[model samples]
Target: MTVPERPVRVLVCDDQALVRAGYATIFAGYGFDVVGEAPDGTAAVRLARELQPDVVVMDVHMPGIDGIEATRLLAGPDAATPAKVLVVTTFHTDENVYEALRAGASGFLLKDATPDQLVEGVRTVAAGESLISPSVTRQLIGRYATRLRPSAPAPADDGPLAVLTPREREALTLIARGLSNAEIAAELVVSRETVKTYVSRILTKLDLRDRVQAVVLAYRLGLVSADG
Candidate 1:
């Protein structure tokens, strides 16, 4: 069997010892290079700056600094190199999820995810794609809908995405709601294949790398408000 080359470097951060150990073992099994492990957000940030890992698997609720804040510091708008952050947390509706996303996290994953899912999440983020659990994404839209700040100015590239048709916008909103292609098709009365095509177009028009980036843009551009 051909072994997959080790190209992705990862930093694991969590307050609990077992969580870190579990992640280290799981990720290592997939041929990822576990560069370092941190027990809190403060250390996570410092280590990220020092190690320059390809991806940071951050926990939302750490003792000091917190994963959201650390993610912002490392991947936020002002970050120097901005390693990709993939939040792994236990609370599905934690307030930190939004903060992390706004802080430029590439994706979010629940701690209860299957081992296979965990491996996939790391690989997805390392490959420059975003992955958010469907359940959590829906919860995020509902929880933050009332708090969304649509008045925020759109980024420069935002206008270019206006090329999407009205239907496409609908698809985008549902995507932000964390609906899968089948779910979206059911809601829109379209075929699953159609939803897939729309998703592809949306990603292309917005120049997004994947669904995760699309979610970030949807929020930043006020297409899907926190209140929506």
Candidate 2:
């Protein structure tokens, strides 16, 4: 029999002791290792740089250096080996959420999210997947859709992504909109397995590793608008 892999290492950052303990408890139950905790962004950054954790649960607003800035320092384009940061915040305001994501957070979670939701968010981000609440993502897109600039034109339907079929293209659009596979199946009125197949075809045709890159490419190619 094969032995199980090691648990994902997580760093929790929050100003409140109780909040940190709460997350520690939840993560412990899910078989994750809570390797460190920091009460502010400055310390958080230090711990992250030292530990090189698999995931960092960041609180966007904190005293001294804020989480967004710290995230930029740790996970932004310049990092030597970036760690995924999951922004956990109480505020759902458009500016707060957008700023956190723009600062290079791989995912976002609400402070009031259920225990299972919190655990799943950590796991998903650790697995290189983005997990934004559909409701929150939709609201953000709607509010800031017009601010997005137009994408450069695709070359008369010829490019690296041309191998995808019409159905696969549809699936890609929905994926960029952050729809889950089950949701896509319902929207297309097709079986879940059918939707899965289409998604697989889209990924293979485009050579994308996961949905996050698909989302970025959709916006870049104008396949999915900011409003979407």
Candidate 3:
């Protein structure tokens, strides 16, 4: 007999007890292992470090360190072994979303998200995928793209753009434009599998964690303009 795969380990962090309980129930119902819960950022960070969960469902406005700082501690560039963080907050402002991404969150979602959305968000992050909500993708990234800067200087000869071939660069641009793999395939007259391959290659060459990071890098490096 084949052994079943392990469930995704998740840590839920929120200030509201009711909210925490709701998420725990939902996660458990969906076969996710609800490993821990925290009412504040400090506790969240402590638990995350100790448990090393696959995904952390973080709240942005918690007391003490808050989700942004806690995310930084767990997933930021300085983190030794970064865990994927999915920020869930009632606030949908551009600043909050941008700050959370800068802190190394793999994705952002509104607390008002449906149960399906929430469950999928957790699973997506656990699977090493980014989960920026569609609404956030359309509004926040467009409004805040100008505020992002490349993490490192581009080299004169080729720079970060050099690592990607022309087709890969095109795929990255389409990703920045928020096109799904299918949409990209339609646009380029290529197979969906081809588009998927291009996306994977782009991520690998850039050393990016997911598509969300790729979007950020695209804007920061002027691969796609903020106006578009």
Ranked candidates, highest TM-score first: 3, 2, 1
TM-score of 2: 0.80
Candidate 3 global lDDT: 0.88
Q: In candidate 2, which residue pairs get closer than 3 Å at backbone N, Cα or C atoms, i.e. clash?
A: none
Candidate 3 Cα outliers beyond 4 Å, as residue runs? 1-3, 150-158, 189-193
lDDT of model 2 at position 158 = 53
Cα lDDT, all candidates: 0.81, 0.80, 0.88
Scored against the true structure, residue 136 in model 3 reaches a CA lDDT of 84
Candidate 2 global CA lDDT score? 0.80
Per TM-score, the best of the predicted structures is: 3
Which has the higher lDDT value, candidate number 1 or candidate number 2?
1
Candidate 3 lDDT, tens digit per residue, 154-223?
A: 5422678898888898899898888878899999999998998998898899999888788887877777
Residue 8 error for model 1, in Å? 2.1
What's each prediction's TM-score? 0.72, 0.80, 0.90
